[model samples]
Target chain A: MPVIEVNQLHKRYRDQVAVHDVSFSVEEGEIFGVLGRNGAGKTTTVECIEGLRSPDGGSISVLGLHPARDRAELRRVLGIQLQASELPDKLRVAEAIELYASFYPSPADPRELLERWGLGAKRNTAFGNLSGGQKQRLSIALALVGNPRVAILDELTTGLDPQARRDAWESIEQIRRGGVTVVLVTHFMEEAERLCDRIAVIDAGRVVALDTPAGLVAGLIGGQRLRFRPSIPFEDAVLTQLAEVESVRRSGPHVEVTGGGDLLHAVTSALARHQVVPGDLRLEQATLDDAFVALTGPAAEN
Target chain B: MNETASATRTMARAPQRRAPRPFRALAVAETRLFLRDPVTVLLAIALPSVILAGLGAVPALREPADVFGGIRFVDYFAPSLLAINIAVLGLQNLPTGLATYREKGVLRRLSATPMNPSAVLVVQLVINLVTVAVGTVLMLAVAVYAFDVPAPRHPVGFVLTFLLGTSAVFAIGLVIAAVAPRARIAAGIGTVAFMLTQFFAGVYLPKYLLPEVVVRIGEFVPPGIGAFQGAWTGDGPAPLQLAAMAVIAVVATAVAARFFRWE
Candidate 1:
């Protein structure tokens, strides 16, 4: 059975609709990505699933239990790391972990979890005294301590440095390998592309596209792109004569060739034959970020 | 697989047995944090005690014999001091602390876990109650031994009045925390409210000494009526006024729950 099933979920705040008919299901042991710009209803949808906010319409089930109706049961099975959530200023890192663990029916040992997250050295430090990265790590450790069947993390690597972000990514992968399902909500394209098993791009409070990163990139805008700074200025007629040259565009000092299959050989052979070797010849593949921009247009601005 | 499943089940059931520990831990955590800051601890406990002691020292501060019926100023002011201490902890201290918690997103983190918002609030109230209890015991000890004030004629009545009055004021603090735009604004409002209650509610001076207009206005305020009639007195106020105070406490609590912002 799917670990989470959200069907036709709608949430309205006053006159504004925050989530409109959003429907998706997360498979067990899968890293499901909910990608969206700010105000795209990602947080609202997840909050509904976590039973923090009541949905105005439709239904949500986590681990075969209704979220709002079986809130306690849902809380028992699922853990959440909310965006911008905080602990009391005076609460120590170890105390915060212990405090959260006390709420669960079966929680990981606080000391063990802290040590595993490399927070043991700073365990005595008050939450307010910790640096931003340390705070984020502690928050993640709290979410994992419950040993929940499913973990929901919102904007996981938002404010972390590159090294810290990479460490967090490894930690998430470790959790997923331990048979825990993950639902990640993030606006960072690189984060989504690197960690997500399958991503649902949300736009204007709706799911605009959903697919694996490679599939989305492939489906949105064909295949490989051949870009080069042509050694000699070529006319449109010369570019069209090359095989596998589906489309060509000139911007400033370079020429961009877009197409599929054997394009590299065709372009290189054409260049050699004309004695026109490009200064910088590079092959570029369509990325998730490109697909996101293409599908949502400018409205998906993060 | 079956053995692993059984192990998982056992692990899951373990936490249920230890659920209450977290609530106690949280309360202890709050108490430690509250007492860690010397300034705040002083403001919470010593401020009311000092004010009460200072007021009791003045001979002319005593109420007329007709009103208090030969009661000493210390006897009259001691119970009110107890109530004032509770009010400060609940009405002023709690609101500001909760508002800062909300402002800093502390409560939001607690909410995301299995901890209910009500649980957090209960822990805070419990800590405040403990502090108030300690302050009351110390204040009463000084009143009896040093000031030679009479013991409460109706101890049960005094305790009930103190609990109800504190709950009412605490409820007001919760409402202010819930509705205030920011922590700084909540602190400002709490300070202003504290001063207003101290001045108008007869905690600092008897309502009879105030202008006729102020006395009339004091009748409508809960703290004023609570201090006047709920504290140790010859006969206390009418049963109807006590019932009104109880109702106010309940309604204020309900309103606070309605508007409470978890984030």
Candidate 2:
């Protein structure tokens, strides 16, 4: 059974509709990503799931409990790492573990959990003195220390350097291997692609698309995009004339052709017929980045 | 797509287990933090006592005076110093600590855990109470033993007044922590309140020197030194003074609980 089910969830503050018609379900033991740009209601959606925010409309069932009405029950089973949440600066690593552990009826063993998360040696280190990556790892450890059945981690790597981000991803994968379901909310496409089993793309407070990483990329227009600067400039129609080509557009100093089956071969053939050799020859397939843009659109970023 | 971002209210949710273990754990952690910074702890808990000792060192204050009703000036000032001790913690330390937690999202973070957000606050209160208790003891020892300021004649009344005064002033501190948007602002407001409490406690000038109306008015103010003095001299534990402390304690605590912000 799905561990979290959000249906037609809605929330607003004053007059601003923060989340409207949002819906998704997270299955047990999966890292489900809620992907979106800034202000897309990704955080709001997950906050509602975590029982931190009450929804204005629609029902949410998390582990068969209502998020708002059954909050205490939901809290026992659901762990949350809020975006920008912080610990007391002077709190030592081991002390933090002890404090957070006391919150649960049956918490994970602090010593083992610390060792597993690579914080065993740094047990005496204060939170303020930890490196960015260590802080992120500690946050994840705190989320799972409760032995919760499900954990919601929001923007976990927003500020970490690339290496730290990769390290955090490993920690998350390890958590998933331990049989805990995860709801990962993030804006970084690469993060979602690397860690999420399935992603729900939210745009302007609505779910634009929901699919696996590859599926999202594959499902985008024509499944492939070809970008090249012609050796000799030619009419945009040269590629547009092909049966497989759907849209022919120009990106400065190059032409972009997007289409379905056999698009790469068809475009190359058409370019050859025009006596034009492609410079900076690059055959582009879809990426989650491309999928995000196609789904959310460049205009949506503003 | 503007996010409807605002601070989340830490709503009281489902029945919580009446467990003392979590509270103890948090209290230990808070105590560790308190001790970790010795400068702040010493200044908050020991400064007033040191100031009292300094006053006792002055020869003029050591001599019994007419206005003091046969009590030494140092002895008259010592009990008010106790009130000042409570005032410092409530006005300066507690508000700054709680407001910093709120500003840094510590309270908000605790809300997400299985931990009730109120636990964070209660633990702080518990830890500060320990500090205040320790500070109270150390100051009294210095007053009675070090300075030979004879112990308060009505010890029970003195202790009761101390407790009530602590409640009243700390409630005011809580109100500062609750409404202050930033930690620095909380500190600023706390300092101003601390100064006012000092003025009323006659720390800057002896009551014999102050105007008659000012003395009467200071009796009604929080950490009311008049009440503390009345209890110490064995003549009066004025009912009206006790009532004022009780009223401030109940009203300010309720206001603080109602208006506190988690983030």
Candidate 3:
């Protein structure tokens, strides 16, 4: 069974609709990504699922429990790392994990959790004294202390440096490997692409697309761009006349080919027939970044 | 990474697993944090007693005075010191602590746990109440033992008055905690309230010297000094004053319940 199911979820702050219509299901152990822009309502949706906010419309079932009515039960089993939640400045790292552990019926041992999360050395460190990456890791560790079946992490790496972001990605993958379902809410497409098993792209309070990283790129803006320098002079029609070639353009000594449907094999065979060696050849496909922009549209800039 | 998963799995499937008590853990953790702030503890626990000792040191205050119902000023002022502690803590200490928790997202994070976020505030209230009780007792003991001030003649009245006044004043503080959008604002408002509360309670000056209108108006407001003072004096806890305290407690607590937000 899906660990979390949010159907036609709707929420509003006053008259402003924060989540217009959102729907998805998190599989038992997959990293499900909720990809969206800043105001695209990803946080609102997850907050509702975490029982922090109630949806104005539609129903949400987390571990087969209603988020609103079964809030107490759901909280016991669903670990949540909120976007801007923070601990007291004086709270020590180990104290925090141990305190959260007390809230669960059966929780991971704080000492073991600290060691595994690489926070054993900083166990006595105050929250304010910790570095940014350490704080993030600590929060993630706290979320997992409950030994929850599902964990929802929002804006996981918004302000971290690149190195910290990489480290966080590894932690997330590790969490998934522990048999916990993960819901990752983030505006950073790179994060979703690298870590998420399947991403639901939310745009302006709606799920615009839902698929794996490569699937999102392929389904939304599916195509390949081939760039190469030919060893010998060749006619443009030799590539353009073929079915896979959409257009042919020459920039300096390089011929760029844009097409789909096994274009690499088709173009390579055509070049071989003409006795032209394709040197410095590179094939480029649209990334999740491009897919996000294409799906969210230009309005996301505002 | 493999170590991380294996460690987590092992801990999860460990034998002898049982739930840790949340309330005790939160209380212990909260007390540790409270003790870390030496300045706040000093102000909350020691300031009242120090002020009482200062008043007791006044030689003229030991003399019987008609202005203070023919009793020595030390006797009357000593009991009212408890009221002062209540106001300072309720108006300044409690509200700031709770609002800071909300502003810092501590309350919200706790809400995400199985334990309700309001449980933290409850624990906080208990801690503050206990602190005031212990601090005020110490303050009173020093004055009684050192300055020869008599102990409260009405023990039942003293305890009742303290609980009533604390509930009323802390309820008012709850209003500030409920409404303030930020921690600094809550502290700012609480400080202003504290000043106003002290004025009515006659902290800046003795009540006999204050204007009739100020005293009359102060009777109806929080920390209701009359009830608090009466409890400490030989004969006090006037029925009218007790009723007033009860009303404030009920109404303010209701308002706090309606308006309080976790985040």
Please tell me which predicted candidate would have the highest TM-score against the true structure.
3
Over 4 Å off in model 1, which ranges?
Answer: A228-245, A249-256, A261-281, A299-302, B1-20, B55-72, B206-208, B212-220, B224-233, B236-238
lDDT of 3 by residue, A122-217 (tens): 999999899877888888888889989999988888667888788788878988899989999988878998999999999889999999998877
DockQ of each: 0.49, 0.35, 0.77
Native-to-model Cα distance after best TM-score fit, residue B46 in candidate 2, in Å: 2.0
Q: What C-alpha RMSD separates each model from the true structure?
A: 4.9, 7.8, 2.8
Per-residue lDDT over A117-211 for candidate 1, one digit per residue giving the tens place of the 0 to 100 score:
77999989999899988998898998888889999999898778898899889889998999999999998999899999999888878988889
True contacts recovered per prediction: 0.70, 0.70, 0.87
Candidate lDDT (C-alpha), each: 0.78, 0.85, 0.86
Please tell me how candidate 1 rates in CAPRI terms: medium
lDDT string for model 2 (A2-63, tens) is 99999999999899999999989999999999999899999999988888888899888999
Q: Over the stretch B1-263, how does candidate 2's per-residue lDDT look in tens digits?
A: 13222212111211242323777788778888989988978977897789988888889989998888887988887866776668778888899999999888889888888778888788777777778878988988888898887777788888788888889999999999999999999999999998888877777787777899888888877877888888877575788998898899999999999999888
Ranking under DockQ, best-scoring first? 3, 1, 2
lDDT, candidate 2, at A10: 97
The runs of at least 3 residues in candidate 3 whose Cα sits more than 4 Å from the true structure, single-residue gaps closed, are A220-222, A231-237, A241-243, A274-276, A298-302, B1-13
Candidate 1 lDDT tens digits, B47-161: 6567767876787754446555576666655654554676677777888888888887777777777777677778788788777777777777677666667565557766666
Residue B117, candidate 3: Cα error in Å is 0.4
RMSD in angstroms between candidate 3 and the native structure over all alpha carbons = 2.8
The count of residue-pair clashes in candidate 2 stands at 0
